[model samples]
Target chain A: MAGVAEFTKFPSESLKVGKGFKLAEVDPDTTPGYPGNKADGEALLEELDDKLAELQEKLFAESKFGGTKRVLLILQGMDTAGKGGIVKHVLGAMDPQGVQFKSFKAPTPEERAYDFLWRIEREVPGAGMLGVFDRSHYEDVLIHRVHRWADPKEIERRYKAINEFEARQVAVGTKVIKVMLHISNDEQKERLLARLDNPAKHWKYNTEDLKQRAFWDDYMAAYQAAFDATNTDHAPWYVVPASKKWYARIAVQQLLLEGLGEFDLEWPKAEFDVEAERRLVERS
Target chain B: MAGVAEFTKFPSESLKVGKGFKLAEVDPDTTPGYPGNKADGEALLEELDDKLAELQEKLFAESKFGGTKRVLLILQGMDTAGKGGIVKHVLGAMDPQGVQFKSFKAPTPEERAYDFLWRIEREVPGAGMLGVFDRSHYEDVLIHRVHRWADPKEIERRYKAINEFEARQVAVGTKVIKVMLHISNDEQKERLLARLDNPAKHWKYNTEDLKQRAFWDDYMAAYQAAFDATNTDHAPWYVVPASKKWYARIAVQQLLLEGLGEFDLEWPKAEFDVEAERRLVERS
Candidate 1:
């Protein structure tokens, strides 16, 4: 906690969405509260790594004992917006055992047969674990709205369902951090071109991405509408300017650090009689 | 693949168990084929990091396309023999998304009702993923034998069941690397004492570990019996020297490297027309 103050300048509060916040107005290239360049941002991330790992271990310890607190980081964005990058660079700093990661693809026929949130509810991180959702239930709204896969009336009902669902998560001690990696249209085009140019990166290129890019504006409008309905103090949305990958990595790491720091995490007391156990171990 | 030859001295072939291998013959303090001190071993691990990460991502990419190959690393040892350490220092180097890890504990009533492999079969890693088991079905034989919880006749049946189960996994494209983190009684004592001294580590200490310690000789014999019964070329067992933590880490890392490198993993060819997709992205 000693060196954590340096990152307080770009507190999660600055990136949080409030009433009437417009997604179109956010500059995808802006580094927001971070004043440093790429090198400096990377250095800060390296410094924050130990703190994040320590807190995560403590949270894991708490869960094994009597603590019920856990975290779920939901990443929502268009393809090539750096969701996978953040998973590798930011959350990757913690031990794999402490992190529960799930990447949602197209739902199976069985999943579609249930309520939209049914599959999502099953993947929630248990007490003391850090759960990460690469593409989450938000897709049901974001992609569904953009493609008109569901009627407008049904889509409207989903926003309220999402809010209530998230509130219940908060009530159960899960600190949900929902993030939209905001990258410009031009940035995405550049990324896609870079993927196409490298033979090694060909596996990452999906033709569906082009179809999604065609409806970028529609997706943005859907995002804003969903934000207006679902953004609450219990589980607020953070729009990370992801054009500079370094800044987004550090920002997400800091947000998680701040979330874990809120809990007064101390080691649990020994459950058994220490002296008796000590004598037994000494003799053995 | 260039510098990988440097580690050929400790190729997994050297550690693989054959008929009549004895657990007591292994010196937990020895570094086996690793011709290096602690600092040298640590440095080598750092150098191997990028190579391991690259191979893992290729495996993941292959899974998404059409590869069925996968790996499962099983770790078994007396308490405090560095199973968790190997996971943090070695498997932690790969992308967390590509590595699927599960730590088995005492089975619940639900788990006990089915055949022993019921829960284990459910957790096997899918295509192109690296699966790790902190403790596994081997426990059914090891602890059950030491405790006499299962009669001798029942215990004999489980060894054949485990071999058949693993052979099936190998036939279906899983390269199972089973390892026993061999640590001495002195090392276990020191580690247990260290845990008792640190409040933060108290949760990891269990009265059961001490109870299990009282049966060290019995447990060793039980392990040897298991090795004699179930060791097969399809799923080989390696005895990793656990006293020197750095040596164990590097050895396990090398074992996994060789496992993944056998696949001839080239970047997956583009599934769609690359030039056409490039043009579509450019115009979008």
Candidate 2:
């Protein structure tokens, strides 16, 4: 593992994934808040709400026409990484009916029998649905590789399969957005302590999680490799600096708005037979 | 059609299906909320948020163990009955990753060929997932019956199937919550006018929707029947007065907290290789 100072200084910008997928850093510095900094992000949140509502109306209007565009959002991170919090705060303003969220757990006996992506494929968003995956297929690489559940060769093959899978979704008009919530180890400790200190929040803390935390370096290495192989123009990873919850959430919403903005979602127009409907009302 | 005065005296709580199913009406005045009231409800919202977050932590703790528990919440209503607003503000406090939402639409060619529940069953929450259905299986009884899309006998059969299906879910330990967003026609007109008058909201209005509005009486009858036949101890429907969005949202959060509170979730004892974790951290 790198020194604390060295790790903190790690260039968050210009993440070089692989040969074909060099995602330009969406600078968190440009965002309203940063770690060691505080602002009343709630004011900006209201503005975001207004914009989101407008966008949502457009999306719903498109749905009235049976529009088929779908968006898949994947959030992956370490323990106490704030993936759940980010999702809640970011989508705080949108209508929930338009969105579908899936949180992957350890594979069940049924899931294990099938291929790795089988369960995940089942959860993928249909046309016109917004699917948010909390700790997605990447788990096959993260936990499986770390625990030796799969051999290195198999893990490598799975990584390629993921890239191809995402590319296929994009080709079929599914916009995919992957976000990695990046936080410092010190900040993670603070959050874990916070969870433990509050009785109501105590349920969120698990000492068993520290075992996985011990493999921080290995997980980081695994993340780098997976990002290298899977990040592509079709589905890119937005490494979000998540020390500040508000800023991290807004960053995700911005990415989603940009992705969905590419679609021309117009409401379908049809004439209404008011008299017929009224007669039907009388008969019923 | 009933006159305005007739509507004023209508017993909104009564739900009777076909011939036999008759769900006793609880007093509508004491149900959730009513028209022109929200000042006190705002404070209740903050308290609701605290309560819901606590329940969410417990739900998360349960997920840490091997098996997953999925909760499906269904919200059905007339247009402008506050379905969108209820979903937006109630789930506004819960963790998004733990919840997946799906709003049903008019069946497409692909969907019409199969049984009505096919697409919906596909959207069912996986283990550890919470799913919210906005206008769900009830549509077969409500819209289909009201519009004469199916015979009354078929609709009655569907009600039986729905009852058995929900009972099966309870047998398997799935907690199902169904809420009917109830609003008066007067309130609906005010909301619709508000949308039409606001430029930003004009996009939400569809001329064709007004034709459906003409059949408000028929839809209400359909809804009453649907609720009566489907409401059971395993999956009861809460009739929520949604003239006030704040009151409605808070009510939903409270109901959800109560539902999940039935499960006294505790964290599995912390079992971590403490020495191994410390050694790994020290080595790093």
Candidate 3:
């Protein structure tokens, strides 16, 4: 891990805090190489998709019976990371109505007036719904720390606030799963260049992004600190190796299924009015 | 329109205006149905999908080249009103990488502290990307109005604020398309009952939803007011008859294609170094 190209070098170890709290920090060595692992990634993604679809159906059925719960999955990553692609394939299997995807942005003047978690809570999915966040409140720590937008003491307070907030959500039965997609700067540059040269995607390029790219090391350091501090059992972080978009999506999908699998989704009893059906049939 | 049962009657001729504009009131008996009479709704939808797919490819190619102007389509409607189905079919034709879908929900403490549009601006698709809002900031009018969370004066102010917000987006070259999936209450009830009885949908059932169902009249009144206040030529509301989910999807697909047709998307000229390529190849 130490001698390999820094872009592909990742620490190979799991951070375990007692029994139920374990952080799977993906090792770059174990991570699949793109194109080389495309076949395996696609197959795994498809398989994960099938299971998600099946479980989602059951989850929906349970929702229809007057007892439904919502699922919120959050994705965090640096620019040029594979959050968009991850969402595309992971949700490829479920019915659209069962899902709601939301991508959080920088706080506006109005948002600035409120506490950090305020905007996030408003978008929580209702029962029987699914909400996906591309970047979430954790930005308070990651981006804020990197940009020096908040005091160190305040950032410290926010880490605990985020953990407690997530715990409260989990306590309320919301299956909260967070994923941090990690991609190397080389890959990021490659993808950004692709975006620059592709006409259909020409609209996505911005001059400002290049300036931000210069601070890659700073962002990574901040991310490492944020992930280390905020990752907890209630809303644990899964550091995904996203050099391969397909494999990243597969891993995230499987993680989601594993988390949601706790809910015994089943078809509830339907109270059909037999007499009303018969009367309607007679009238017709 | 006057005599139909609550929330279930199709106001085939309902006139809708958005933000500081007034449309001629729709009288179901007098207003003509589906004036774009070149083809059946379903056929038109297919054509729209084909065209949209073509345009999306061009758009993504531009995106790949470094353009960031993204498109955002907003869909708004009541429960069982086919928002989900429309999303599935209309967007089914686009490349997933170029598009992202979002659904707005009830405000959390964080969201409540900010203005309604704060969350929305973040969700806007970047250039070469497509963003879809299953339900959007218009909720300020629909739910906030009905619940009296905002005074009438504030509601009135929102009409202009929303209009200006969307127009500013259009000015910046974001293709904004809004679709109101309209369905009759009778149709909605049929669908809801079906969901209840269908074992696959039991998980989607919620007792609270039924409680909301009892206030159908209030919701429709709110819908009528919302469309009346916010519909504009820039982002005209396409009221698709959603009695048939397939047809609704197709209608939305067509509208998307039409909106995207304005872009002059093309591939960029690449500056490749032939000598470098040859030398690199020989070295390998």
Instruction: Assess each model's interface with DockQ, reporting 2 decimals per model.
Output: 0.75, 0.29, 0.15
* Per-model TM against the reference: 0.97, 0.74, 0.61
Clashing pairs for predicted structure model 1, backbone only: none
Q: Least lDDT summed over 10 consecutive residues: which range in candidate 3 chain B?
A: B4-13
- Comparing 2 with 3 on TM-score, the higher-scoring candidate is 2
DockQ leader = 1
Best by TM-score: 1
Report, for every candidate in turn, its global Cα lDDT versus the true structure. 0.89, 0.68, 0.66
Poorest lDDT segment (10 consecutive residues) of candidate 1 chain A = A1-10
DockQ of 1: 0.75
Candidates, ranked, DockQ: 1, 2, 3
Q: What TM-score, to 2 decimals, does candidate 1 have?
A: 0.97
* Candidate 1, A6-80: lDDT as tens digits: 554655888899888999999989888877788788888888898898899999998888799999999998899
Model 3, A103-173: lDDT tens per residue? 78778999999999999989787677777887989888877887889999999999989888888777766
Docking class of 1: medium
Score candidate 2 by DockQ.
0.29
> Which parts of model 2 are misplaced by more than 4 Å?
A1-36, A40-49, A66-69, A144-156, A185-208, A243-247, A257-284, B1-36, B63-72, B108-130, B174-176, B189-211, B227-234, B244-247, B250-254, B257-284
Interface RMSD of each: 1.1, 5.6, 7.1
